[model samples]
Target: MHTIEIQKEPVELYKILKFEGMTSTGGEAKLLIGDGQVTVNGETETRRRRKMMNGDVIGFRGDQFHLQLSTHTETI
Candidate 1:
């Protein structure tokens, strides 16, 4: 399993897919999701803008990922 850290809560599904390189573009992510190629928590997720938070598991194309919130402090 892989972990993807996000700075915020409630990220859109397609954005994560695109950001994680699961899809080449946001449009591709949308299509993939719409085609039922993605799963959330072991169930098929067809909502492209589905809200995803920490602890959510996403599976696609034989790869699984766990969503986590970045806890590292950032220095300006």
Candidate 2:
């Protein structure tokens, strides 16, 4: 399991995948999501643009990630 911290409340699923280096490119992230290779909270998620938030657990390629809001407290 790994942790990914996002500064914003809601992030697009594909962006998270790409940001976390789970996929080499944005296109690959989209393809992986569209192919049902991603899961959220243990359920398969196929929406490429699904909104992801804090506490959301994402699973892909046998790896799990727990999303956390960055504690920087700076207004974006």
Candidate 3:
């Protein structure tokens, strides 16, 4: 299981996949999600724009990721 920390809550599913290098591009991520190649909390997730929040478990291509909300906030 891999841990992914998000600075904010409710990130879009496809953005996560693309930003995390799961897919080369956002379009690919969307296609993959649409093809039922992704899961959330152990259930298949097909919504490319699915809102992923803290503690959400995502599965893709046999790999698992645990989403964690970053508690540290940066101040200037």
lDDT tens per residue, model 1, 1-76: 9999998989999999998888899999999999999999999999999999999999999989999998988899
Model 2 Cα lDDT, one tens digit per residue, 46-69: 999999999999999999999999
Q: Output the better candidate (1/2) by TM-score.
A: 1
lDDT by residue (tens digit), candidate 3, 1-76:
9999999989999999999999999999999999999999999999999999999999999999999999997989
Candidate 3, superposed: residue stretches over 4 Å from native: none
Best by TM-score: 3
Q: C-alpha displacement of 30 in model 2, angstroms? A: 0.3
lDDT (CA) per prediction: 0.95, 0.95, 0.97
By TM-score: ranked, best first: 3, 1, 2
Candidate 1 wrong stretches, greater than 4 Å: none
Candidate 1: TM-score? 0.94
For every model shown, what is its TM-score relative to the native structure? 0.94, 0.93, 0.98
Ranking by lDDT: 3, 1, 2
Model 1 worst lDDT run, 10 consecutive residues: 15-24
Q: Which residue pairs in candidate 3 have backbone atoms (N, alpha carbon, C) closer than 3 angstroms, thus clashing? A: none
